[model samples]
Target: MNDRRIPGPLRRRPAAASLAAVALVALAATACSGKAEEEGGGGGGADGVATDIGVSDSTITLGALTDMTGPYATLGASVTQAQQLWADQTNDAGGICGRDVELVVRDHGYDAEQAVSAYSETSSQVLAYSQFIGSAYVNTVRERIDGQDQVLVLPQAWSADLLGSEYIQMVGSTYDLETINAIDFLAEEFGLGEGDTLGHVYFEGAYGENALAGSRHAAEELGLSVAEQRIAPTDEDMTAQVRALAGDGVDAIVVSAGPRQAASVAGVAAAAGLEVPIIGNNSAFAPQLLDTGAGPALLANYYVASPALPIGAEEGTPAELSAAYAEAYPDDQLDNGVAAGYSAISLLGQALEAACEAEDLTREGVAQAMLAMTEADNGFGIAHDFSDPAAPSSTESYILRPDADTPGGLTVLGDPFTSPLTDSYTRE
Candidate 1:
């Protein structure tokens, strides 16, 4: 194994182009419509699909379809916390364009039907959907956002469909790319042989499927074959899944689940007796998973992605973000989901900021602001430019490995690698 996990500052960053903040212009869009009505939504969804109805006054109301309970609770919690931190920071710093932000949280319990109801019920009131989970659920309500010309989306799942169209802006690597990122790092940085079979254990849902699709693509590209296993989210007994994987002599396993579901599958996979490495989705980096009584099963051979810096995990990235969020929310967990939420809000803040600058606070205007944003610093990773209508996406994904040794608990590998821009996403 020729593991090489060092900083590669040699890679040039994408030019600081303008990002599209059409949401900010949303206020202007409604304003320009003359007889425009707030209609209750804050923003649109997928390809500028109107998931959120409209916004009135300077205060923007954002609707969210979050997972407070069920499979993704842990990750959902982090997503919520991140958004909360952003709101607090923005509010404290005098909010978007001198206007206060009104955020509404609705629990989806990781259910698609519940998600649709939550979005439908709240869409009429907020301007856009924030921190909503799953592509399955997002697709359910995509048209509503489009019909109203609203922008409703954030940086969550790595679904590939978001890469095209103007309705949605997904801010991470695509399914194929994110999955490839982990394998790429495992092989290039961790120094593993291409002949090894990459074991995959995932839920039978879109979240897991998207990853599976991506991993399969990458594996083929990397000259690797995959040993696949699917398990129910609620099934506690993973003896079947793990044993099947072990029987196949799997080399490495990448499991995707929120927390509870992840713990169930990870525990099974670890105890499956192969002693292979067990990797997980970015959401699996929570302390909950490590402390799930799956000790050795996870201790050394287990790793996951720290999408955002863990509370105070590493320096430069983690510490800085931690401090900012801590100051924003003096009392909170500041765990995994919060970090993601914080980043999402920061992006939204930038969108709003640009919208204010463009004098386009209407739905279309804010969408314009979100999409036309040239360049602005929101204190996160890279300076995103959403000016390109043809290819509306940003590729900024950080790689992290959290182990027992690090005092802060997580170790960041290197600078975030840019997902192929052409294959990136557009925030709806």
Candidate 2:
């Protein structure tokens, strides 16, 4: 993995810039049409003729609304690269059900308004959204998607609320479930069972609150005490929060924010001479942290709970996928984000293939295909079952500890963990 921070210029590569410009002009020219193209003749059944917005005789267009220039740009870049790789491979294999896949990537800058504007411009030209990067931006356009009958593959699985959207397919466990599994792993790993105090440092929103719900549930179930401090996402320094947790003498700290916040909490706690382990939700940790001044602190204390196995997990589909990615993009870092992007696209491909088989290649058909999926192989160790509409795609997760030898700066602690809480968890 590269230790250097992602350069700003890398976000605006000339090829992508030109693609965006052309897409914008094309969008403007067809803005008044307000109707999708109806090209026919494809691999679907008689009724499965391609007539949707982005489908044609030889191509199927999909849109990716990502944060290429925002706070999560590094993660977004990895995701976009992975998606492109999947599309390229699919096209090379005679395309999905005979039509080539065309992926249109757009930068939303992690801003709600920008995401909405970008969606509006590209909505009429695409069959579905292959990626919607941020929670806030997804919320901004959630209603629009439902109204337009468009299916979306969401980047964040932090909120159960997203499950309410019939058109959205979440690729992994919800934040709450991930946290529950994390607590279960930590309790067993550290031999600190009943009566231990757990501290939660979180951002104040659906993501944080959902994670807190799991912590509180675990506390009740395991006879542990809980303390919490909520902060804004913009808050960089967490010295005061760590001080408070330290003062409370919490046995462990659970972070439900982003990478910067994770770095801050770990660094601050270490600076305060507190030594309890600091566990982070999937979104909380990034490999880039290893390159920062806080690397030592994170390496010493930070553990991550993720729904998928690390890309480099030994002798499995994951390792194979990682090898393929390295061959495709040798210079790029192989991290959880890249794995996530690949999994999302892989899941979408399954649905697309199913839709093609059923001869119903419309947006509704894709949603139906996804909902009908009994299980999906992510090209990783885990397989998600989506047969139950009310259940999440995944409910188990692996506990990862930082390791210098791993591509993602982390290695799986053991086999993936699943608690009874997973089976019963549902959207509130």
> How well does each candidate superpose onto the true structure, as a TM-score?
0.79, 0.86
Model 2, residue 1: what's the lDDT? 15
Q: Candidate 2's residue-wise lDDT over 1-428, tens digit each?
A: 11121111101011001123234443453343344433322344334564556777778888888877876677788788888888988999999878899988899886655776777677777777778876555655555566643655555445655665557777777778789888877777786568889999987766788789888888877888998999987788998999999989899999998788899999988888999888999878778888888889999988999888777688565677777788999987777777778878888888889888887777777878888887688666677766554456777777888776788788987666566644444334
| Winner by TM-score | 2
Prediction 2 TM-score vs. true:
0.86
Which pairs of residues collide in model 2? Answer: 45-359
Give the range of the ten consecutive residues with the poorest summed lDDT in model 1.
10-19
Assess the local accuracy of residue 75 in candidate 1 as a C-alpha lDDT between 0 and 100: 71
RMSD of 1: 8.0
- Give stretches of model 2 more than 4 Å off: 1-48, 421-427
- The weakest ten consecutive residues by lDDT in model 2 span 9-18
How big is the positional error of residue 213 in model 2, measured in Å on the Cα after superposition?
A: 1.3
Q: Give the TM-score of candidate 1.
A: 0.79
